[model samples]
Target: MSASGLPMRLRVPSDARFRPILLTMARRVAESVGFSAADAAAVGQELAARTDAVTRKAPLAETTPIDVTFDVANTNGAVFRVRARCGGSDLEVTRPLPLA
Candidate 1:
């Protein structure tokens, strides 16, 4: 896929209720970039886990917004990255994408 639609950013409430939506969005982005179904799901899970850790360390207000960014890069290999930020806390997760 082209990079035109890349570098996407999403802002969602910090409530745990939004976790599923976040995970599904992460999975869909991974799949759009050629990740297998299982791999995409794994990526989503990893993002959720990392975000959880960050939020736990620095608790955010229920109405606080978490900004999630998704991007793809090609260096030695294709790589997908997800970054989540809330208040003063931030976390990033990366997964290698399968070569086409």
Candidate 2:
């Protein structure tokens, strides 16, 4: 586990089957960044929706590699960011974090 509130870079096959794993990781990262359980769950849901939207707009081959990066290292910052890139399409989502 990263002490810097979930700084992760993942390269996974662009398959819908991997969504659950991604979502789980997102939620865990959120929790590590001081989000309540409910908030973490919401983060996961939002991440999933954003990912789906990105894929829908620019579809990728199942075997294509998707790069997902979670940037929560700036725990003092006001927002957390998640970025996903696949098939030349990029999606970035930012969510506000609870104040310390």
lDDT for each residue of candidate 2 in 1-100, tens digit (9 for 90 to 100): 3555555888877789988877898898778777899988888898788777767787678877778888764555667777888888787767887788
Index of the highest-TM-score prediction = 1
Q: Give lDDT for model 2.
A: 0.78
For model 1, the superposed segments whose C-alpha errors exceed 4 Å read: none
Number of the top candidate by lDDT? 1
**Backbone collisions counted per model:** 0, 0
Residue 89's lDDT within candidate 1 is: 81
- Report the C-alpha lDDT of model 1 over 45-67, residue by residue, as the tens digit: 99888777777777788878889
lDDT, residue 79, candidate 1: 88
